[model samples]
Target: MGYVKTTFLMAAMTALFMGLGYLMGGAGGAVIALVMAGAMNLFTWWNSDKMVLKMHNAQALAAGDRFGLVDMVAQLARNAQLPMPAVYIIDTPQPNAFATGRNPQNAAVAVTTGLMRSLTREELAGVVAHELAHIKNHDTAIMTVTATFAGAISMLANFALFFGGSRERLGLIGTLAMMILAPMAAALVQMAISRTREYAADKAGAQICGHPMWLASALQKIQHGAAQIDNDAAERHPATAHMFIINPLHAHSRDKLFSTHPATANRIAALQALAGTMQPNAPRMRQTDMGPSTTSVPKVRKGGKRGPWV
Candidate 1:
């Protein structure tokens, strides 16, 4: 159902873009807009992950890093039956994380230093699993496309506004309305698609981690921490705000129509409901009877040492 909704919304966004183009320059303009949107999406599909990581200055973690963060991701990846993804640590105090890649094979997971220091071992696992779920479900790719289209639509609106597009075809009043409402409509559609994927990712993350309560607990902490700490990187790149496990931007409107992620309280309630259905001792993975062994697990550093947040 989520995918279906996302598909419909994406189509609507495209139609909106083409319509704006027609309003601006007739059939020729519509064709040009469609080509530009397609080209931009293709470019974003190939390079968005790299661009996002670089924007946040994420540093890749080595497999043998003493912090054992990569090791933890390794274990979770095994449980999720996903190929090991490149892990990165962001140099920020905000407790947050996100996943990005075109597909599972090329995926990457990044967490802020604040997240590591703030969350417990179990809570961290839950967070990582949630990001991995995004990779497994290919949400990153879908979101990139959505963003690309949204951006293109906004640009088209701006172009029309500045140039007084097709003034003869669309009266001055009609052009003014397009300039004001077109970008707002694009934003609404983009936010709706983002909200839908977030719920699906939450459900799949809980299943992958085998502990709905773990994520529920993590979300609570991250939400509180994010509210207190300002992420400069997120502030500068508001468009990428939707990629995070929690909304990293501050001063968000309470209206759901404008919010990116689902409300944290509502998300926690859903997880708590999911927890009610699982057995108390149910194993995390259903594919294998045997549980993950701790023999190879590395000792995570204890004490409040402020190491890099990976």
Candidate 2:
């Protein structure tokens, strides 16, 4: 997402928060909610990275690890003209990755161990580049903040249940509907933004890596793995779903209004379009599109950089 879009999302989320407050306690509640929203925005700007990393149980990746993962990220960061971002490993079995921070200077890229086990070195670089694109675009700050807003909105919606009909201007029935609908509305906006940004990231990442097909190939593998394996952390904290390259909670092969990420096929198609120009006569990405149940990445190799880095 761009600065303009991020600003819009921030406004929309605060509005949702305030609207819920008004429903529960009238104008006075709206004032309080506005104050809370301002505080929350500032809080997320400073701390959302730490909160998200903690939420997923992400651990700092050992520097100069045997995987060469850290080194690869460093190289890519240089390629993207970005400062080195913190690298983290999430121990989930699902193959997915995300970037988080308030800005490019403080960003972090997190990948699952399952991702290390599933994607080739080139594919992993593609994923990292994609995340860097998000960091470079300042999408992480908004995304992390959005997750916090989404979660808080859900909580506030639930809190409305405790208020009697007379207390809420909406009354009991209206309160119940808002309780159900408010968070859903927030999620819809979250997903919509995610879908839009994923495409932009894919393009920028391809340019950063200088190989569109690499990311296209990785997306196919990740989509397949994500669909079959469970990401327990993501399921527990569903609000963070939009941060991932692929929605860790569920797999969607087609686009929909509420889907957290774009359809895998559509993303691949977009990347493939880039590949056509950058890599003339390159064979279409195929055969590697099957699920992880049927296929796994090649083992770490000693000589060249074709296999899994880990």
Candidate 3:
């Protein structure tokens, strides 16, 4: 189902690119746009993972250096029957994580520093497991490909604006209308695809962790933290915001129409409902309006400071 949606969205994005080209340079402009879009798609397929990681300035962590983090991820991968993937850390205050690569064999998982400090070991496992689920289910490949196409669509719109479009049949009015509407339409289609993939990842991640509550808790923490802190990298490169587990952008006041992720409240409710089905008597914390419940997990402290490994 994800693959199908990505395919449809990519097709729409590609068509949008072609439309922008036609408005800019008639048949000749479209020919150039197609060639450029095709070339970009090929390049992105091979290097998109690296591109995404680099965009966030993520650094690879050696197994020895990240023993605890690696071990947790390894255990979860074992549970999911997936091959071990490289682990990385992004030096950012935002509590977020993301998985990338074309396939599990070449995949990498990245977590922010704030996530390490904020979540418990069990909650971290739940989060890592969710990212692994994305790799295992091949969501990484789908999203990377979708992003490449969607990016090209927007690029084409920009190209149209810069090159003054084709001097074809469309007079002043049509040209003006196309320039104003094309990119917005492309963004809408791309956001729709992003929303669907996120929901699918949430469900798959919950299954991988075998504990929907853990991920629900992690999501609550990440969302609240993300809302407060700014991920400068994400805001500067909005194109990559969808790659993060949560929308890393700090533009929180925007309505759903302009936002990338689903409402945190809705996501938590869905997870709670999933938990209910598994164990009718499962322990649940009493959740407040938008925060985690009153129940708290004990913090592990080291050197008089709470640490992530705890």
Candidate 4:
């Protein structure tokens, strides 16, 4: 159902893009705009991971780094039956993570310094598993295409506004309508697709990690931490906000219409419901299973001082 909805939304975005093109230059313009959109999507599909990582100032994690995060990610990838994705760390205080790539084999997972400092070992595993789920399910590819079409639509609208639209086709009233509503329509379609993929990723991630509660707990902490600490990179590049596990932008009301991620509370509730069906002991992580001499899980406190994990 989620995939079907995403497919429909993506098609709507494409149609909206072509409509704006037609409004700008009739049928010829629509065809040109579609070709442009296709070319742009192809470029993004091949290079988006590198572009996103560079945008965030992500640095590669070398094997010699003693933090054990790379090792943990390796284990999770094996569990998901995916090729090991390149690992990176962003030097930010915001507790967030995202995955990018055209497919599982070429994927990269980047987490913030704040994320490593904030989440417990199990919670971190859950987060990594969630990202792996995105790679496995090819949500990255879906989102990249959506963004490409949305961007192209907005570009067409901007061009129409500046260069006097196709008066022969749309007239004054139609041109005015396209100028105001086209970008908004694109945004709506993009947001709908993002929210749906987030839900699917959460469900699949819970299964990959073998523990819904772990991700639920991490989401709670991440939501709280993200609200308290601003993610400068995410703020600067708002279009990339949907890529993160949590919405890294400033807090918004629970209105699903304007938000990139589903409400954290709503997502947590869904994960809690999933947790109810699993065996009670199934989600517990053995400390020894983590590499040697790893720190114990941090006890997160609400509205209190930062813990030792940070």
Candidate 5:
């Protein structure tokens, strides 16, 4: 049922894009706009991982340098039956993560320094597993296409207002109406489609983690941390907000109506309900099956305080 609704929403978004193009100039302009959108989609599909990583100034981590995190991601990928994606760490204090690539084989997962500092190892695994789920379910590709086309629609609407529109097409009233409503409609379509995809991804991510409570806990932390932090990159590039694990922008406070992510509370509630069905005593799988570690733990600094890694 969710899949069906998502398919319909995607179709609607495409239709809206094409219609906006038609309004901008007629058949020729619509064709040109769609062709450009297609070309951009293809480009973004192949290069979006690099683009996003650069946007956040994220640095790829070597397995030897961050062996623990690398090993955990590798183990999760093995369980998910996926190729291990390139991993990166962003310096931001926001506890968020996102996955990008055209497909599972080419994917990359990037998490913030804050996420590593804030989450327990188990909770961090849940977050990585959720991103792996995005790669597995192909949400990254779908979202890249949606973002590409939605931006094209907005571009076409702006073009119509400035260049393509003619005074004689209709009266002044018609021109005014098109200018006012076209961009709003395109934005509505983008938000509606993005929200649905987020829900589907959340469900798939919970399944991948196999313990919904981990994700519930992670979400609780992310929602609170994200609200306070400024993700400057996401702010500069608002079009990519839907690609994030959490909406990385702060501009939604005024309207709340335009947010691409579903309500955090609602998402947490669903995850909690899923957690209720799992056995409370289920043992968590380890990165290595040999046994628990007996080595001395490394020290970690938090809030200017020192502690042993737990």
Candidate 6:
């Protein structure tokens, strides 16, 4: 059902993009706009991971690190039946993470330093699994296409002001209205698709980790920590906020009508509901299987605060 909803929303976005183009000009103009959008999105899909990492000043986590994050991610990747994605750590105090790549094979997962300090080993696995789910689902590709469509629609809407042909088609008043409503409608659709994908990822991630409660607990802690810490990088590049597991641009406020990510509370409630259905003897990934050192002893991070994550 979730996938069905996502497909329907994606189709709606495409229709809206083409319809906006038709309004801007004619059938020929629609084709041109779609072609232009596709060309633009190709670049986005190819380099989005590198671009996002650079923006956040993310440093690659080398293998055999003392913190065991690299090894832990590798174990989780195997559990997810995915290739081990490149791992990175950002310097921010915000406990947030995001995954980027066109597909699972090319994916990279980046987490903030604060995340390492905030989550237990099990909670970290949950977060890693969530990110893996995004990679497996090709969320980066979907979001890039949707973003391109939204941008192209907005561009066409604004271009209507200068293009005399558009005025002839929609009339003066009609063109003005299109300029306003087209972008709004496109934005709404984009938000819908993003929200839907988040839900799908949450469920799939829980399954990959074999513990829905672990993710639920991680979400709460991350939500609390994120609200207290401002992600300066995310604030600067507001456009990329949707990529994170949580909305990093704002505090843990109530879910808004057009928020990029689903509300943490709602997501937790769903996970809790899922936990209710799992069998008592189901196979579960033990936290010890991740790395040599357990979450019991808080490994002091060099050049950072020396304390175990709660």
Candidate 5 local lDDT, 121-208, one digit each (tens): 6667778888888889888888888777777766666666565443356445666676667667767767777677666667666666
Expressed as tens digits, the lDDT of each residue in 1-310 for candidate 2 is: 3456757877888899888888777787788777876678788889888989999999998767777778788888888889999999988778899999999888899999889888876688889889999999888876767777787789889988886632446767877888889999988777767777889899989988878988999999889989999999899988788899998877557897778888999989999998878755432222222112223566557684433444
Off by over 4 Å in 3: 1-3, 27-31, 161-165, 253-255, 279-306
- How many pairs collide in each candidate, listed in order? 1, 0, 3, 0, 0, 0
Runs of candidate 2 exceeding 4 Å displacement: 1-9, 163-168, 278-296, 299-307
Sort by TM-score, best first. 6, 4, 1, 5, 2, 3
Which scores better on TM-score, 2 or 4? 4
Candidate-wise lDDT, in order: 0.85, 0.81, 0.75, 0.84, 0.73, 0.83
- Taking the tens digit of each residue's C-alpha lDDT, what string does model 4 give over 1-310? 9989988898899889888877777788889988999899999999999999999999999765666888888777877789999999998989999999999888999999898878777888889889989999999988888888877887787678554556556777766677778888998898888899988899888887788978998898899989899999899988898899989996573846878888889988999998888766443444654554324545667885454434
In model 3, what is the error at residue 202, expressed in angstroms?
0.6
Per residue, candidate 1 scores C-alpha lDDT tens digits across 1-310 of 9999998998999999999888888898899999998899999999988999999999999887765778888888987899999999998989999999888998999999888877767777889889999999899998889888888888888788555455667777777788778889998998899889888988888887799988999998899989999999999999999899999995353537789888888888899999999766654733222223221213457774553333
TM-score of each: 0.90, 0.85, 0.85, 0.91, 0.86, 0.91
Where in model 6 is the C-alpha error above 4 Å?
Answer: 280-283, 292-306
lDDT of 2: 0.81
Tell me how far the alpha carbon of residue 159 in candidate 6 is from the true structure, in angstroms, after superposition: 1.4
The regions of model 1 sitting more than 4 angstroms off are 162-165, 251-255, 279-304, 307-310
Ranking of all predicted structures according to lDDT, beginning with the best and ending with the worst: 1, 4, 6, 2, 3, 5
Cα lDDT tens digits, model 6, 1-310, are: 7668878887887787777777666898789877887888898888888988999999998898767888878877888889999999998889999999888889899998888888878888889899999988888778877877788788888988778777888889988998998888888888778888998899888988889998999999889988878999999987788889998977436667678888899999999998999777644677576643345436777787654532
Number of the candidate with higher lDDT, 4 or 5: 4
Evaluated at residue 183, the lDDT of candidate 5 is 68
Model 6 Cα shift for residue 297 (angstroms): 11
Clashing pairs in 3: 24-165, 24-166, 25-166
Candidate 3 lDDT trough over 10 residues, lowest sum: 285-294
Q: Could you give candidate 3's per-residue lDDT for residues 1-310 as a string of tens digits?
A: 8768877887887788877777778788789888987788778877877998999999888765643677667667877789999899988878899999989998999998878878876677778877988898787877776677677766665555456544345656665666667767877777777777777777767776677988999988888889898898888898888778888886463337767677777777887888777655432222221123223534655566444332
